[model samples]
Target: MATFFGEVLSVFSRAVEDDEEELEESEEDEDILRELEEKRQVRVHWGPALELIPNTDHRLHCPHLLLTVGHNASRFVSVFFLSRGDWDAVGHVSLWNERTLQSEGSACVLYRHRDSHMLMCQVDCFVAEDQLFQWTEQVLSSLEPSQVTVLSDCPAAEYQSAQPLGTAPRLRSIHTSACSEPTCCPPVELPNLVSGLPAAVMSFCQLQNISAVVYQCYSDVRSADSTAMDTFRPAVEQLAHSLNLDLCPDQDVLRKVISQAAVQSNLYI
Candidate 1:
């Protein structure tokens, strides 16, 4: 996401906590339509991506955002609200020509060590080595893409570093004699996900292929029986218009379907 988009996420995340109050304020204006229109902005984007770290014991039931971002030739960003753990994010950047021999020969591998927030991603898909390094620099420059480390090592060698993003919350591990006892397992707390994007967020990711790639990853990793990942297209697209209009229950809808997720393919989009 761009600097403006990140600010928008902060705005919408804060708005989710203030929905009741915002709803109440909207009611006082009498013109419900106009109140909604004031919610539109192009600076923010809200969407979903798979957990880089998967759950081993229980199925998570959070509402993963389900909108698609279309394809484009320019750079754009998608910020995911991680469901495996609250607020831990995994971001994607649409940054390749996607139409070259080198890119065609390229591949990537992703690894997530047990019981850690650390994710090590090694990329192999790129038409040019300079462009690959450039994109890595751009991605690392932002805080939203936190905990990322780029390496120029060959395909055989892997680097290890304890590089943690400054703003991300630390994942606390449980260590005690009770670890081997099944009866003492702690309860799992699922995050209550907010599905629809406020107009601002929709425009931010829709700028390029941001939303499309986001929906692509989540759809690919989503469990077969998980219908909660489904979303209505008209509702998602109207987000920009939703800032001014009411959503109809009968809007024609479409589901985001992606056959590839990085979790399965281990490749950056």
Candidate 2:
């Protein structure tokens, strides 16, 4: 190329210009990823009920917190506790990830008893591994619960036993050092480890010196059903007296819950 002054100049090739554009695009993509990560962080939203607490500090003083993770456990809580209509929807936690399918309203909901200091959290959505710790922390930070109980479900195949499996769903438990109540189920065996949100909550409780117990039900059936839900009945009954929860909900409500779950699981629907 020649300039107007008659001086010769070398122009860069199209390939060099294209490489520069690609570099700029790569930088833009990195920015987008960073922004998306920030957006995906786990967040807890408190409802008006919690905000209207009489306490000066406005902190939720939960005497007991019952957390249910996964479809089966959530269904159990739905049928046995929430169906009573004595609890108020006090808050919810929201997070964005590839595995999460439920909307924010239904994913992770917090319900507080109308008259008692007990709170129940039902998590029906999938929480990714990286977000587990953040989810646990954000959910627990608002509440000062004396004791925490976690109910979760997993595939029965994941459980390893030397003998043949039984008819009923197997229950495995893990608890923090501060826990005082005796676990209704046996301790989870080695090599069959607890993971995901339940494990994260347990770890957080342990580190915080909060009394916590996790009851993990291993169901043979792949889908949620009354049978799997029943496995937690004993544990629920044990805690019901102390928590002032209903030991047995109406059979009609139980049927309704199971039917709704069945309809959702149907492929033809």
The TM-score values for the models, in the order shown, are 0.20, 0.90
lDDT of 1 by residue, 183-253 (tens): 22122112211122212222333342232111211121222111222222222332214223232321111
Give the winner by TM-score: 2
Which ranges of candidate 1 are over 4 A from the true structure?
Answer: 1-91, 98-114, 127-130, 144-269
Model 1, 52: alpha-carbon shift in Å? Answer: 14
- Which pairs, if any, clash in model 1? 36-243, 37-243, 37-244, 44-201, 45-201, 68-211, 68-212, 69-211, 69-212
lDDT of the candidates, in the order given: 0.26, 0.84
* Pairs clashing within candidate 2: none
Model 2 per-residue lDDT at 95 = 89
Report lDDT (Cα) of residue 15, candidate 1. 69
Residues 148-215 of candidate 2 have per-residue lDDT tens digits of: 99999988887887864576788889999999888887899887899888999999999999999999
